[model samples]
Structures are given as C-alpha cells and as structure tokens.
Target chain A: MNLLFAAEEAEEGGSGLVSPVIGVMLWTLIVFGITLIVLWKVAFPRIAEALDKRQRMIEESIDTAEKTKREADELLREYRERLSDARGQADDIVARARRTADAHEQESQAEARTKREEMMDQTRRDIEAETRRAIQQIRSEVADLTVLATEKVTRKSLDSSDQKRLVDEALAELDFAALANEERR
Target chain B: MSQSRKILLGAGGAYLLLVVLAFILFGSAGRQDFVPQEEFELPTWIELGPLDINKAVLYLLISGILTCVTMVYIAKRMEAKPNRIQTAVEVLYGVMRDNITRGNMNDKMAAKWFPFIGALFLFIWFNNLIGFIPLPTGHHHFTVLGLEIPTFGIYAATANVSVPLVLSLLVFFSYTFEGIRAKGVGGYLKSLIPAGVTGAMAGFIFVLELLSNIMRIVSLSVRLFANMLAGHLIILFMAGGLAILLGIAGIGVFLLPIGIALYLFEVGLVATLQAFIFATLSAIYIGGAVAESH
Candidate 1:
C-alpha cells in the first residue's frame, strides 16, 4: 500500500528539485521538435503566406484609391480650365458683335444726313427757276397793257421800236429782280 | 442600490459566515506536516527501456498537441475579414512577428527563425496556463460506488527544473550555432568582447563574456522554473497547506481569498508574461549572435 502511494513517502536526502532527469529532457526535445516540425511543414507557411497576401491587398487597395482621387482632381481642373476659356471666348464674341452694331448705326445716320442735304439743295434750285419765269411773264403782260392805254389816250398805233422801248421802261420802273428774289426766299 | 451591488453584498456576507463557521468547527485539531515536495515529485507511470513517462511528459505532449492543432485550425480558416478567433490569432501572430522576431533582427534572419520562436511561445504559454487548472493527477483518490478516482491537483511542467533546463539548453546551442555560422568560431568569440579595450582588460572581458554566455542557459531555465514553482507553492500553501500544518484548518478560509487572488494574477498575467519574456529573450540572443557588434 505504501509503495503504491508514492507521494506519501518522502525522499531522504534533497527534495530532488534541481535534479536533472534524462528521460524528461529527452521527451521535451522530442515533443518540442515534433511540434516545431509539424507547424513548420503544415501551419506556419500557410499563415505567413496569408498574412503577406492580406498586407499586399491592403496596400494595393490604398494605392488604387489614391490614384482614382488624383485622376478625379485632374479631370476637375481640366474642366474648370476649359470652362474659363469658353467664357472668355463668349465675352469676345459679344464685344465684337456690339462693336459691329455700333459701327452700322453710325454709318446709317451719316447716310440719312447726306440724303436730306441733297433734297434741300434741289428744292431751292426749283423754287428759284419758277420765280424767275413768273416775273418774266408779268413783265410781258404789263408791256401789253401799257401799249393799249397809250393807244386809247392818243388815238394812234406805235411801231416795233416804240413797243420795245416802252416795255424796257416799264420793266425798269417795276423792280422785277427784287420781286423775284423775295418770292424765292 | 443597483441589483449587481446587492448581489455582491449578499455574496460577501455569505462568504464571511462560511469562514466563521469553519473556524468554529476545525480550529483545535493537532498539527500535521503537509509537505509540498510530494506535490512536485514526478511518479513514473510507465517504464520504457530508458525513459520514465511521468506527469511532466504528459503535459508536454498535451501542450504540443494543443499548439499544433489550434494553429493549424486557425490557419486553415484564415480570411481577409477575420472572425473573433482569427482576429485574436492575428494579434498573436503580429506580436510574434513584429515585436519578437522582426524587432530583434533583420528581415532575412527574422524570416528564417520565426517558426521556431512562435512554436516556443505557444508551447510555453499553453503549459503555463494549463498549470493553473486542476486536473485528476493527484496520488490521492476518492471512492464512489466501489470505484476509485484520482483527486484533482495543480501542477506545471515548467515548474520542474529539468523541462526548462532542456529548453534553455536548446536555445543556447541554437544561438551558438548561429553565431558560429554567421561569423567563424574565432571571429564570433572575438566579437563577444566590447570594443576599445586592450591588454589584460581585453582578455579579462573576453573571459567574462564567455562565462556570461554560458550562464545564459542557467539564468533562462532557473528564471522560468523558479517563477512557476514559487507561484504554485504560494497558491498551494495559502489554499490549505499552511492551515493543515498549523492544525488550524479554519485559517485556510481566510487564506483562500488571497490564494484566489494570486491564482488569478498568475493565470492572467504571469503565464503570458513568462512566455513573452522567454520568446523575446530567445530572439534577442539569436539576433545578437549574428550582429556585427555584441
């Protein structure tokens, strides 16, 4: 019974606390070596590979995202530049059209003024001609009436030279040139 | 008060009453010697020509199997988006890779030695953690329905000096081999001495460095063995050993709480910490061996 219960029997000398046991050491070596081998062959390689893959995946994802953002920013900048150029072009076109319209208006006003001046000159010339003709006719008619009155008073006919002289005297006495200038004004 | 607070108060009062009752019943018994030696002694279960299979060997086997299986399982199921267990394993993997291996050595060396260091950490960690758990390994037995069953007891393979000594010896040889491989034997030895010393001082320093290099095995082994042995001894005594030796069983009631706290401290911090220290020291030694300067 005492032999079966080994823990109940105390050792005589030391407690054997620091004593080296060859079997235990050998077993430790064997067990640890086996574990290390199994893990090295089966488990560790897979895990290391997976971890490396995951790290690469994360890095690639980050790079792709950064690249996309950079492209988007570049596109936005280009669009803004194009829009600015278009706005400048539109402003230039509007200015050119306004300038052309202004030039056309000035040209039309000058042409209208020239046409009015020509019409006024032509009307003055016509009035001068008509007044002159009326004055000449009046002179002729006066000469005829003077000849009839002279005949009635003296009871005698006059010759061609006498008629001409009487008409020139009547025309001079009447101031027919001044009358024609007043009618033209 | 809150419901949790009320429950806590009730539990505390109950525990106090139980202690008082135990003190009244068993305070006057005659003293008895409950030696701790018996607990640490490894009784052989089987004899094979040159080997004696014992509790320590069993524990080592269990630790090896557990380390292998758990890592393999997690490895097989690993994904880009990890679940809880995979996340935890990844954290441990990072610690081993970045903090232990890569932190100590360059990429080429780290890659070469990561598997060994990782296995060493998991093995030691599992051994330490399982030591705190009570298992049916005690020499004493209980009878029920005419059947005998061994009682539960706490023990650690690392607590036995032989196990850690063997592991330290392995580490010592590994680092020495690496040093010799990286630099020839003469160069490696010469590198051990610090720079800018001459004459007798240089010789003396070289001898001292050689002795210190040899002492690494002892220091590494004893540090782990002593810490584990001390923690288990304290816990055992505080639980009942002291009370039984003093003939005052009731004293254990008071000591049990302290024992519980120590138990938690060992399980929660010391176990993991010892593993980390052992693995980190191994990495440092290996890395130092190949370095241009000591």
Candidate 2:
C-alpha cells in the first residue's frame, strides 16, 4: 500500500504539480464555498450583532448618566433659586417687623409722656383748690370770732360788709403757704 | 522541604513519568531504513474513471464539514452576556475581524468584506490545525487483517497542493474580480504597464507584472503547502532516526528532544503562521484590488 501511493505520486505529477489536481481543486472549491457561505450567513453576523449591541448599550448607559446629571443640575439650580427667594422674603419680613416694632415703641413712649404731664397738671390744680377752700373756711371762722367779741363789748351784731371786710383782712394776714415756704428756707 | 518545593518536585516527577511513557509509545517504533516512498504518494481514494477522490480531498471534505458544524454551533449559542466558551469564540472572531477586515480595508469596505475574510481565516486555521491530529491511517502502509486500508493515517489537508491551490485560487479569483470591478476591464489591463512607458520597456514591464500576477497564485499555494509538508516531514525524519540505534527501546533519544520540539513547533508556530499568512495575503490582494494606494 505504501509503495502503491508512491507510484501514484509519480504518475500524477504529469504537469509538474500533482498536489493541485483538477478534480481535488474543484472538490476543495465546492467544499470551501459551502463552508464559507455558512460562516457568512450564520457565525459572523451573530458575533457582529453582539459586539454592536454591546457598543450601543455602553453608549446608552453613558447617555443616561449624562442626562440624569443634567437633570440633577437643573433641579439643584431650581432649589437654589427657591432657597434664595425664601431668604429674600424672610429678610423682607424681618425688616418690616423691625420697622413696625420701632414705630410701636416710639408711639407708646410719646403716649406715656403725655399721660404723665396731664396727671401732674391735675394734681397741681387740686392742691390749689384745696388751699383756697381752707383759706375760705378760716376766713369765715375769723369773722365769727370777731363778731362775737364786738358783741360782748357792745351787745350788737356786725353788718354783712363788716364780716366781709374782716374775712378779707384775716386772709391777707394769714398766708400759710408763704409761711411754709419761709420755714423750708 | 518547603510545601511549594515538595509540590514542584511531585509535579516534575509526574511530568517525567508522562514523558517516559510518550517516548515508549511513539519514539520506540520508528523504522530506520524503511523509507516510506509511498508516504509521499497521493492516490485516489475512490477512482471513478477521471473523477478521483484522493486522501487530500477526503481530508478537505472532513475539514469543511467540521468547519461548518463548529461555525454553526458558535453562531447558534452566541450570548449577549457571553459565557466562557462564548468569550473564547468572540475573541477568535474578534482577532480575525480586527486584523483581516478592518486592518486591511476601510470601515465600509471592511464591513462589506468581513464575512468572506473571516470565513477564509477560520476555515484555513481549522484546516491547518486538524492536519496535525493523527488518525488511524496506515503507518508506512500496513494492513490490519489482510485488507489494506489505504490512507488509513492522519493527513494534513492544507499540506496538500490541491487544497492550498483551491484556497489560493479562490482568493485570486475574488481579488481579481474586485480589481476588475473597481478599475474596469480596460483600466485594469492598462495598469499592467507603468503610466508613461511607450514601447519595449512598456512591454517588458507589462510582461514582468503579468508574470508576477500569475506567480501570486503559485506562490500562495506553494508557501502554505511547503510549510505544512516540510514541518510534518521533519517530524517523521527525526522520529525515524530513533530506529537507527536502539531498536524499539530508544527513538532518537539523541534526537528525541529536538524531534518533539520540532513537532510542537510545527503544531504551534507553523500552523498558526501559515493560516495567518494565507488570510493576510488574501486581504492584501483584495486591498490591492479595490483601493488605490501607495
């Protein structure tokens, strides 16, 4: 069998290349074509598709992250704006209240000063009236004493003018408020 | 001893034992003077008058069917979330596509030609690899039970001229067709000579370019075939030297290390390199055809 193949090699080498026979070349072509077609149809496409899908998926993930980040930045900006607005409103309210409080304090202070001035004036008027009443009562009493003394001497009642004149005189002579001022000095 | 050292020693002993066993099986039985003159011969497996099915053809057929089956399986079981086998398959396909298609052509053209390029790469790669695997073919042409099983041994299909010839021819046809399509028939023919040459020099350049173009097919086939064939022959020659001295006891004990090393080199380097060369050359041809560049 070994020698048989050796003989075949020599015989087949007619055109200087036995290895590239017409029949086997055709056979190889046919077989190779079939296998290549199958590979083209099935294997390569699936692999490419998987690789393509992986690439797209990676891009999509990155895109989603970027979008989310943008949205977060937008939300943060909104919150910051709102926070500053609230701060402005709070500051405005505090300033308004402070002005209102200052106004209220000043108004109460003016009202208190007016009320004290009125009370002092009323007290002074009461003191003056009381002094006048005491002086009037003392004058009446002095006039009655003077009438009684004259009546004892002459056994006659005093006229009205006389009583009036006597009371006036006694009020002029007894100045208790002036005498109290002198005592204090 | 340290634990690591102990483990290393144990592993070394085990490896030594395996090597010894391999030498006994493959090294001892090499025939020294028994020149397998028939080993070079390639007769028709089934002769139907002129339509012969030789061992090379049979190996090609086997390679084709297996290539189809494997490719189909890879396509079918592909996952978006790849598992281990899927990852490995993806890596293989990635290498072919990246190096051959995108490396050779522009993106659009690469995409267009990916399937063809990948097919050639994978088919040739598998064919070259399968050649090394030993089958039950006859060793030095022996019979089992009074009946000779012709070609009853492993054969490297790619090592055969017809196989590489067919493959290279396919490439030649494709690239040539692409060239013609790109440049038109008139322009492509006109390109045979340099742009300004008129008479004898033009003719000379045309003849030279024409000869080189024809030689492309020859060189492509011969390169792959010779490499594969030479690698196998070297391995056999070394193993055959074992029977020169120590009978069945020692096979190229002197040559054992070198023989085994050469065999591994054949299996690893030559196989991969040839496949790459074939595919890359095809791409270059296609590139020359479709695109105009320096």
lDDT of 1 by residue, B168-274 (tens): 99899988999999999999999899888888999999999999999999999998988998899899989887787677878889899999999999999999999
- lDDT, candidate 2, B1-294, per-residue tens: 999999999987876776677577766554445434345456666886655777666677788889889878877877778899888888878878888778887787777777888888777888888887876554355567897764444457777777788788888898888778888887776665666888788878888888888899999999988888777767765765334433453444445567789988988888888888888888878877777631
Whole-model lDDT, model 1: 0.86
| Lowest lDDT block of 10, candidate 1 chain A | A1-10
Which residues of candidate 2, in runs, are more than 4 Å off? Answer: A1-19, A42-80, A83-87, A94-106, A113-117, A120-185, B1-31, B34-41, B106-112, B140-154, B192-206, B234-270
Query: What are the per-model DockQ values?
Result: 0.35, 0.41
lDDT, candidate 1, A15-85, per-residue tens: 33567678888988998899889888888888888888999999999999999999999999999999999
Query: Clash pairs of candidate 2?
Result: A19-B162, B136-B152, B137-B152, B137-B153, B138-B152, B138-B153, B242-B252, B252-B255
Best by lDDT: 1
Cα lDDT computed for each candidate against the true fold: 0.86, 0.75
DockQ of 1: 0.35
What local lDDT score does residue A179 receive in model 2, on the 0 to 100 scale?
42
Give the per-residue Cα lDDT of candidate 2 at A182.
Answer: 50
